[model samples]
Target: MKAFRLEELEAQRAANQGAYLQFLRERNMSVGLYALDAGQADPQQPHGQDEVYFVVSGRASVTVGDETETVARGSVVYVPAGVVHRFHHITEDLKVLVVFSPPES
Candidate 1:
């Protein structure tokens, strides 16, 4: 079995601008770790695949479509494919575990 440590992943360079470390890619799914500094803007846009974000640490306001919610450690957020989503107003450094179904190409 393959395993990963979030601390190690966090130390790697971010592939998606704001420190995104893609650690796994299976036949049906992909997983990654994303980190954003407290005052940094989230440059993400609509994704092509369905996704789930598990908040690993920190706090922020996540916007999915027209709805917005505050999320913290242990919180989970879901986003449908091709929908508008982003995180803003971060109160602390944010660490998120990201999963994409059908694997992101």
Candidate 2:
């Protein structure tokens, strides 16, 4: 069995960005805690794999194609493969938990 603490993961680097913390990864899945500074925009594009985003704190304006959703703490977003999505307008220091399936290569 393996256990992880969010505080520990906060010290690691994932994409050279300042707003994301990857807490765990195993098999083809991963869990990441994200910290979005105010005015930050989460990059968007098509992915070969599907992913889920769960809001842990603050608010986010998420866009998936022509549709947009306002997410807050305790909210969740599910993104399918090949869909274009992004998180934006991080008014507060947004914290999000993301899970990826069939991990990217």
Candidate 3:
């Protein structure tokens, strides 16, 4: 079993681009913590594997292809493999738990 604390991970914001702390990695899947400050843009591209985003705190507008939705704490969003998606109009500091299947490379 593995354990993680968000507060500890948040303190490791070593870059202005937000903090991406990967905590769990297995043969079939991986999990990570992503924290982005308000007004910051997400610099991510489409992934080769399916992914799920579990919002741990804060709020944001997430765009998956042509559809956009407001997400907050406890919200879960899914993006299929190779889909275009991004977070914008961040109204609050966004802290999310990211899960990727097939273990992203």
Candidate 4:
């Protein structure tokens, strides 16, 4: 089993963008915890793999295609392959559980 402390992961943010914490990665999937600070939005791009997002803490507004939804703790969102989606308005340091099938990276 592998374990990663949140504090340790938080210290390794991707230098090119907003902060992120990757906890695990394997051949077919990737799992991680992410934090989106208030007013932050990652670039939107279409991916060839399925993506699932579960709001672990705080709140966020997610846009998928022409639809947008407010997701908070316990809320879940799915993005199928090729869907154009992005996250935003991450108030209060939103924490999210992210899973990607056929891991992009």
lDDT of 3 at 79: 95
- Model 2 gets an lDDT of 0.77
* Per-model tally of clashing residue pairs: 2, 0, 0, 0
Candidate 1: regions farther than 4 A off: 14-18
**TM-score list, all predictions:** 0.93, 0.82, 0.90, 0.78
Query: What tens digits encode model 3's per-residue C-alpha lDDT throughout 4-32?
Result: 77776666644434468777899999988
Model 2 — which ten-residue stretch has the worst lDDT? 6-15
Clashing residue pairs, backbone N/CA/C < 3 A, model 3? none
* Poorly placed runs, candidate 4 (over 4 Å): 4-8, 11-18
Using lDDT as the yardstick, the better of models 1 and 2 is 1
Higher-ranked by lDDT: 3 or 4: 3
In Å, residue 36's CA in model 4 sits off its true spot by 1.4
Candidate 1 lDDT (Cα, whole model)? 0.91
Number of clashes found in candidate 1: 2
Write one digit per residue (lDDT tens) for candidate 4, span 36-96.
7777777658878898998877887899887999999999999998998988877767877
Whose TM-score is higher: candidate 1's or candidate 3's?
A: 1
TM-score of 3: 0.90
Kindly provide the TM-score of model 2 when superposed on the true structure, using C-alpha atoms.
0.82
Off by over 4 Å in 2: 13-17
Best by TM-score: 1
